[model samples]
Target: MAQSTRRRFLLAGAAAAGALVVGWGALPPRQRLNTAVPLALDGGAVALNGWVALAADNTVTVVVPRAEMGQGVHTALPMLVAEELDMPLARVRIAAAPPDKIYANIAAIRDALPFHPDDTGNTQAFARWTLAKVARELGISLTGGSTSVKDAWLPMREAGAAARGMLVAAAARAWGVAPDGIRTADGELFHDASGRRATYGSFAAAAASENPGDAILKEPHAFRLIGRAVPRRDARTRVDGTARFGIDARPEGMVYAALRMAPALGATIAGTNAAGVLRLPGVLSVIDISNAFSWRLAGHDGAPAGVAVVARTFWQAKTAAEAHAIRWDAGPHAELSSDGIHDDLRAALDGTEHHVYFAQGDVADAQAHGRTIDAEYSAPFLAHAAMEPVNCTAQVADGKVRLWLSTQAPSIAIGIAAAVAGVDREQVELHEHLLGGGFGRRLEGDMVAQAVAIARECRGLPVQMIWTREQDLRHDAYRPAAVARLAATLDAAGTIKSWDFIGAGGALTDHFLRRNLGLPGAGPDKTTVEGAYDMQYAIPHQRIAHAAVASAVPLGNWRSVGHSFNAFFKESFIDEVAHAAGKDPVAFRRAMLLGHPRHVAVLDAAVRAAGTPPAGRAHGVALHHSFGAIVAQVAEVSVHDGAIRVHRVVCAIDCGLAVNPGHVAQQMESAVAFGLTAALEGAITVAGGAVQQSNFGDYPVLRMGQVPHVDTVIVLSGEPPEGVGEPGVPPVAPAVANAVFRLTGQRLRSLPLRLA
Candidate 1:
C-alpha cells in the first residue's frame, strides 16, 4: 500500500511538472509597445508606440533605449527607425526612452545562459526560450555585451513600420482611399491616382486614433539609411562641448561631493576626523556611507563601505576629502596579493576538478594516440579606465528622488537609488546623460546608490558625487584575472586531432548576477570558457572547462569580458600548436576551419587586406568568434628597443548587415586601440588587499603615437546584424603576440609582451 501511494505521488509530480512546462511555453511574449508612464512629448508630438513619436512639424523622434557611451548606439538605433519610417536620417531626432521594461536588453541576458553558441539541441533551445521569457518579465535594462543593435534590430524597425501604417491608414481614411493605394515616402503620404500629397505631420494627431495593423517590414534591398555611413548624431554636440556627461550634469543649486572608500576591498571605516574636515573651506557635511545599501551576496557584501565629503564646490570637496584623515579596519582579505591570487588560480588547475562547459567525442583516446602539446597562459585584472570618472547627481525632496547620471543600466539604477533614498521605485526619476566612456564600468549601480546616500543628508539640496581618477581605478569592480591551461594533439598529417582547455578565474557571470540580481550563481558559467569552447575551428575531439575560484575581490564585466583574455590563451596556443606541427599560422587556421565558411571568409579578407608586411615586419593572424560575430585580425609587427611594436593591423569582420558601415569601421579601430592598450600596458596589481594602480600615470593607455594604423574590411553578408562593439577586441592580443613570435623568434606567452 505504501509503494502504491509513492507511485501515485511520483506520477502526479511528473504530470504537474509537464503541465507547468506546457503552460509556461504557451504564454504570450511580453508587450514591447507600451510603457506604464506616457512618453514625454514636445512641440505637440504624438507617441505612436513605445519607440517612436511624430510631431506637427513632420519631425520623427526615435526612442533610443540604450545608453550612448561613444559606441554610436544613439546614431545606429535611430537609423533603424528612420529606414523603416522612410524618413531622412537628418530629420530624425532621438530621445531617451523613459524607464520601461519594453526596452530591456533581452539578448544580453539570454546570451548569459550557459548553453554554448554552437549548441542547437532541444534542451538548449528550451532553456534559452525559457530564460528569455523570464528575463523579459524581470526587465533588466542594460547596454553591455554589444547588444544594443542586435536587441533593437527587429523591435525598432517594427515600431517604425507600425507607426507608418497608422499614418497611412489615417491618410487613407481622410482621402477615402485604400490604405494600400496611399504610398509613403520621405515622411509624406501620396495618392498617385488622385495626385494628392500630404505631409505625415498633417495626420499625426488623427493617426493616434487609427488601428495599427501588422507592420510589413522592408527587405534589406529597400534599406536606405541603415547601411549608409550617416554622421553620428552626438558628434556635433560632443565636438562643440555641448554634450553633457555625468560629470557635466549640473542641477540648479547643486553642491559637490568627493568620496573616499576603504583602502582595502570591502573594508569599513573605523573612524574619521569629521570635525576637522568640516572646518575646511566650503565643507558642508561629512556623511558615513558605509554599507549605504544592502548590496548583499552569499558570504560577502558586494557593496563597498565609504565616506563622502559634501561641499559648496567640487574642488573644495576634493581638497577637504583628501585632507580628511581616516582610519580603516581592513577587511578579511587583507593578506590578498596579486601573486597570491595567481598562485591560487594555478593551484586550482591541479587541486580541483573544473566544471566542463563543452565536450565532444573522445578527447582522451585522441590525445593518447597522437603527439601532444601543452601550454599555460594568464591575464591580469584590468580596470575599465573610462575617460570620465564615476559620478552621479542626486536630489532627495518631496518624497521623491531625482537622478542625473550616465549609467549603462538605468532600470537597475532606479531601484538601487530608491532603496538608498528610502523611497519607492516609482518615486525615482532618472535623467540619463551621455557617457564619456563606459566599456562596461557604468553597468554597476553603486555610484547611483552612493550619490543617493550622500544626497539624503543634504536637506533636499542636490549633490553631485564625483570619484577622482585615483578612486575610480582603485575601487573598480575589475575584470577577473584568469589563468588557462591548454593542451592539444597533432596528428601525423600536421592537423589538430584534439583540443582541451581549462581556465580558472573568479566567475564573472556569477559575480555579476550576485551583485546585480542578488541571486546565487551556480552551474557552469559560459563567460569563463566562451572563447575556448565557442571557437569556430572544427577540431574533432575537444573539451572546455572552467574552475571558478572564489575570491574576496570584486569582479565585473570589462570590454569583451572573457573573450578578451581567452582568445589570447586559445589563439596563441593554436599558433604554438601550428609551430609545433611545422605549418604556417594562417594556413593551419584555414585547414581547421573547413566547416565554418564565415570564419574562413573573414580570415581570408583580413589576410588579403594585410597583403605583405613591410621590411623588418612580420604578419601574424588570429581569428575569433564572439557575440554572434566572427572577427579576424592580422598584425604587422616588429620588435624595437625591447618592446613589441605593432606597426599596422588589418581587420575583417562578419558583423552581418551593418547598420552604419562607417560606425562599424570606427568600432574596429576603437577596439584595436583599447585591446592594444591591454595587450601592451594594462595591468592591475593588488597588495595588502588594495589595488596598486591608481591613475593613468601608472595604469597608462596606449598613446596615439604607439597606436597601429588599422584598416578594416567588412565581409558583406545577408545575415542579421550581430555585435560590432566587442568582437574586434578578442583577436588583437593574440594577433600581436603571434607576430612577435615570428619577428623575434621568441614566443611571448603572456600579455604586455616584454623582451628579455
Candidate 2:
C-alpha cells in the first residue's frame, strides 16, 4: 500500500512539471528589445529602426510614439535618447512614428487592470494576466494616465545606446582598436589610443552596416541632461504661434463642417430642417451621423449619432447649422437627472452584495473592535473642457481613409476611423497633431470616427468637422458623479483599529467593456474605488468595497480619475479622525504613517517647505500615493466674505526621480490649478438627461488671480522614475479641504467645497 501511494505522488509531481513547461511555452514572450533595425538612408542620413536618424550634418532625429498634449512628452521623451547617446539635448529632433505594434504602449494598458494597488490575491493575478494578454495581442498605444515617460523610458534609452554602440564599433574597426577604446560624446567619436576622431555623421553609412551587439547604459551619476531643467523643444514654435494644433490643420480641398450632437446619450435625430438652410448660404449638404460603436464604444462618446452640416467655411457651417432645427427622439434617459442619479448612488450604499476590492484582518467585527466614526462624501460629474475643443478632418475614397487630428491614442483613432469609413485598418492614414490640452478628453477617437462617417456620405470630398465650444462642453463624456460612505474604528488609545469603505458610481471599465467588448463586466473597477480603498493608512482590520450602479450619463477618465475625489473622501475623514482623537492633523497622520518611510519622507518635506504659517492661518496636510508616485501637500488658506481662498501650497513629490526638475515643478503648479478648479467650481449637472453646462462661462477653471502660489520640492532618489502628470493632481484638493475644515469648523466633505 505504501509503495502504491509513493508511485501516485511521483506521477502527480511529474504531471505538474509537464503542465508548467507547457504554460511557460504558451505565454507570450516579452516585447522584443532589438526590434530596431537600420532603415534605408537618403541624402547621407541613416535611419535606424524608425526611432533614431543620423544625418551627415550630425543632426539626430528621434521618432516619438507618444502624443505631445502640453505635457512636454515630445521634449522629455527625446531627452531619454539624448542622455543615453551622449548627444546634446538641443541637437536632438523629434519626428512622429507610424502606427505600428513596435511602438505600442504596453505599460499603460497593463497598469489599468481591475485590481487595487494593494491587491495581491488570485483576483489581482487573474486581472494582470488578462490585461497582459490583451495588451500583447492588441498592441494598444495610448499617451494618457501619465504613462508616456515610464512607457518610453527604457525603449528610448535602448534605441539611443544601441545606435551609439554601432557607430563606435564602426569607428573602432576603422582605427584598428577595440570598441572600448572608442568613446563618443556630442555626436563625435574619438579613439584616444589611436589619436583618431570623427563625427558620427561622417561614419553614418558605415555604422549602418556595423552590428549593435550590446549596450551599457550610463549610471545615474553620469547623467547630464536628466535632472536638469532643459528648455522644451517646441517652446519657440508655441510662443511664435507656429504650433499646429488640431484646429490649425487644413487638408487640400477640405471643406468645413459643424455638428450638434444629441443632448443625451442614446437620443437620436428624428428629423432635420436642412432644406431651408441648404439654400440660404455656402452650405453644401447635411450628412446623417452613424457608425459602428466598436471604438470608444461607451456612453455618449461612442460615435454619437448626430447630423453634420458641411459648408465652405466654419462660420458658414455654424450659421447654417444654427438656422436648422432638429427634433430629437429623447430616449429612455430623458427622465434621468443629477438628483435622481445621486439618490440611486446613495441608495447603493446600503447594498448587500458589495464587491470587496480589498480586505485584511477581521473587518466583519470592526465595529465591535473599537469606537466607530462614520461619514458620507460626494462629488459631482465633470467635463473635460479642453482648450482646443474637438475637431477632425477626414476623407474616405478608393478603399482608403485619411484623418488629421490631435488625439491621445492615434492608433486607436486610426482603427476607429477605418471601421467607420468602411476601409481596412491598414488602408488608414493618420496625421497626428498636437493638442492644446487633453485632461483625458482627447483620449477618445469618437470625434474622428464621427468625422469619417460624415465624409463617407460626401462625394470623396475632404471634410473638417469642428464642434462648437458649447457642443464640446455639452457632449463631452464627463467624469462620473460618485458618493462614498466611510466608517473607521479607533481603539481607546486613539489608534485606528479598523476601516470600512463603500463607494457607488458608474464604472469606467465596466461601461467600456459593455460598449466596446460586448461583455458582462461583472466585478469591482479599480478606477471607481482606487483612492478610497487603496490608502496606506495602517489599520489592523479593514475592508474596502465598491458597488456599481449604472447611469445614463457618459463618463471617462478625468485627470487623476478616482484619486480626484477619493483623496477628498479619505483625507478629509482622516482630519475628522484626528480631531476626534484629540490630536493634531499632521501629528495624527505622522503616527499612522510610521512604518511607511517613503510616505513619511514626503510628509516631512512638505511640512518643512511650509515652514511656519501665520499664527491665525490654518494649515492642512494630506499625503497620497498614486500611479507609482507619492505626494504630500500643505495648503495654507483663509476665508474672506464667505469665500475660501488658498493663499499658498507647499508640495513635495517622490516620483522615483525627477526626469526634468523644471517640468516636474511645472506639472505640480499645473495640477494645483487643475485641482483647485475642481475644489472651487468644477461640476457638471444633468437635467432631463442633458448636460446643463455649455461652455467655460458655466464650467470655469481657476483663473490667474485665483491661482495659489505653489512651492514645489522634489524628493531625489536613484529609483527609476514613475508617473509625473497625474500624481500631482490627487493631493491638492484634499489639502485645501482639510485647511478649510480647520478654518470653518465644518467638515466640507463634498467637492467644490461650499460655504454659507
Candidate 3:
C-alpha cells in the first residue's frame, strides 16, 4: 500500500508539472518572458526581493497576489505577512506581485470541480489532484473568485516566518548568543542579558546571504502578532490621497485615448469617419483599436474589437469620440435581450439533458417514499462595477513598451501588449498600479492590448486609454445570469431525505479550458452548476446536474463566483424547506449540522449577537463554508415606509487562525456593505443587446447612509488559517434575505429585493 501510494504521488507530481508546462505554453509567447530584476529597492528605502523585501529603515514590503476592490485585501494580506514576520504594522508596505503560476489560487481549483470540497473523503488528495488539473488548464496563476488570501494563507505566512528566521539566525551568529536568548520585536533583534542588540537593517545583508532552510513555524498558541488587531498599513496613504491608483499614473509626453465599442456583444467596427472629430480642440489623433489580441488566449473567442480617439486629455477624447460617426457590424447578438436570454436558459433547463455532476445513493427512491418540496430561483447578470473605471496607460518607445495600470493579470497584460506591439514579452515593462477595484473585470487584458495598440500607432508616444464610467458599465464582461431548480424530500420525522439541484447558465470554465485544449465542442461548465448541486447538509441522497446555454453577453467571475448566486438559491431553498418542516431557520440549520462544531459555533455566535426580541428587529441567519473559512451572518431588518432597511448585522467567522483581528473585522464589514449593496440594487440588465445601467446613479451601489451597524465576532479554531477576503461575501446575501423574510413574511426568490 505504501509503495503504491508513493508511486501515485510521484505520478501526480509529474502530471502537475506537465500541466504547468502546457498551460504556460498555451499563453501568448510574450507572457512566458520575464524582465524585472528579482530584487528592487525603492526610494522609500524599501527592499523588494522576489515576493518580499524589507526597507533599510525597517519597513517591510510584501507583494500582494490579488487585486483590492473594497475587500480590503491590500490591508488584510500585508497584515498576515507582517504578523508572521513579527514586524510592527506601521513599517510594512505592499506591492502587487507579478504574474506567475506560484500565485494561482487553490480554492478556484476546487471550484472548477463538479463536486463540493467536503464531499471528498480525502480532501488533501482531492486538492492535489484538482490543483494539478488547474495548473494544466489555466497556465498562469491568476487571482479571481476571492481565492487570493485563502490560497496564500500558508505560503505567504511561511515566507514571512522563513525571512524572520533568517534574520534571527544572522543576529544570533553576529551576537555569539543562543538563538533562544535573542528577543526580536518590531524590526530589531536584542539580547538584554548580554546588552547586545541590532536592527534588522544591520543584519539584512548577512541574512540575505544565508538561504532560508526548512525552519519550524511557530504554533498558533505562541503567536503574538497573528491574532491581534492592527490598523491598516495603507489606510493613511489611501485617506491622504498619497496612494497611486491606475488613473494617477502619468508618463512624460503622455496623450489620452477614449474608446467606444459596439454596444452589442460580438459586434465589430465596420468603419468610422474621424475627420469631424479630429478637428475638435485637443484632438491629436484617432486610431482604430480593433483586432487587439486577447491576453487570455485560453478560451478566448477573438480580440476586443473597438475604436480609439486620441486627444490631449481624457475629456477631449471623450467629446471627440462621441461626435465621431462610426458604423458597426452588430453581430448575431444584436437582437439579444435579458428576457430573451432568460427564455433561452429556461428552455435549456427544461429540455436539454445535463451532465451528471454528483450522485450519492438513490435519490429517486428517497423522493418516492418521502414528502417532497420543489422551488425555482433566478439571478440577473451582474457587473464588477468597481469604483475606478477600466483604464490602462502604455508607452511604446525604442522598440520597448511600458504599461502602467491596475490589472489583475500583469503576466497576461505583458503578453497581450507584446502581441499587439509585435515585440518580445521581455521588452515590455509592466508597472502594476494599485486598483481602485477589480472584482474580476481587470482579469481580462483587452484594455491593456488596446492601449498598446494605440501607443504603437502613435510613434511610441505614451498613450493613456481611459474607459469612461459609461463605457466601463456598458462594456464589462458580466457575471452570467443563472436559473436553478431545487427539489428536496423530507422523511416522516421531518429530516431531509434527499436533495436534487439543476442549473442552466453560460459556461465560464468551458470557454477558457476548451480554448486552451483546442477542444471543438462545448463541454459542461462546472462553475455554473456546482454550488447548488454540492450541498454541505448531511442528506441521505443527493443528485446535481447542469446544462450550459449559449449567450451573447460576455461572462466572467464575480466576487464569490458561483456562490454569489448559488448560495442564495441553495440557502434560501433550505430556509423554505425549514418553513415547510415547521421549524425556525437557525434551528433547522443547526439540526442538519449535528457533527460540524466549527459551523455550529459561528451560527450560534451570529444568532446570539443579533439579540432577542423587544428590539423589534427580526433576525435571519446564514452559514456557509467557502475558500477554507466557515462564516455565519445574522441580519436584523425592518420594513418601514415601503422600504426594507437593514438595521444591524452580526457576523462570526472561523478562518482558522486570525492573522490580524482588525483586518478580519474590517473585511467582514466591507463584505456586508458590498453584499448588501448587491442585494439591494445591484443588477446589470440588457435591452436591445445593450447594457441598460450606465453608472452608480442607475445601477446603485450601497452608500454610507444605507449601511447597517455591523458587529463582527471572530472564532479562532486552532485550525490552519483559511481565507479572509471572500468567505464573508456568501453569507451576507442569504442572511439579509432571511431577515427581510422575517420582517415582511415574504420570501424574496430573486436578488435586489423590492420592498413594496
* The candidate that achieves the highest lDDT relative to the unseen native structure: 1
lDDT of 1 by residue, 402-508 (tens): 99999999998898888778889999999999998999999987788788989999999999999989989988889889999899999999899899888999887
Question: Model 3 over residues 298-382: C-alpha lDDT tens digits?
Answer: 4365335678899998899998888889888887677888899999888988976776666677888898899999988888888
Clashing residue pairs, backbone N/CA/C < 3 A, model 3: none
Compared to the true structure, candidate 2 yields what TM-score? 0.94
Q: What is every candidate's alpha-carbon RMSD to the true fold?
A: 4.2, 5.2, 5.1
- Candidate 2's residue-wise lDDT over 1-756, tens digit each? 011111133335546766554665467755534334444445667875457889988888888889888889888899999999888887777878776676788778878654445446775565466556557567777787788888788778888888898888888888789988888888899888868889988887788787777667888899988888887788899999999998898888889899867877678878877778889688999877754464443343365667788999999998887877889898888888889999999999887856776677876576786788899999999888888989999898898998888988887788778767767888998888999899888877668777888888878888999998898888777788989998888888998888888888888766554543445554456788777667887887877778888767767778998888888889888888888888888888888888788888999999999987786678988898888788999999998888999999998999887788888898989998998898889999888888889887899988899999999999987788888899888888788888988888878888888886
Least well predicted 10-residue stretch by lDDT in candidate 2: 1-10
Q: Which ten residues in a row have the lowest lDDT in candidate 3?
A: 1-10
What is the number of residue pairs that collide in model 2? 0
Q: Which scores greater on lDDT, model 2 or model 3?
A: 2
Q: For candidate 1, report its TM-score.
A: 0.96
| Candidate 2 stretches greater than 4 Å from native | 1-44, 114-134, 290-301, 513-522
Q: Per-candidate TM vs. native?
A: 0.96, 0.94, 0.89
Q: What's the best-to-worst order under lDDT?
A: 1, 2, 3
- lDDT score, residue 593, model 2? 82
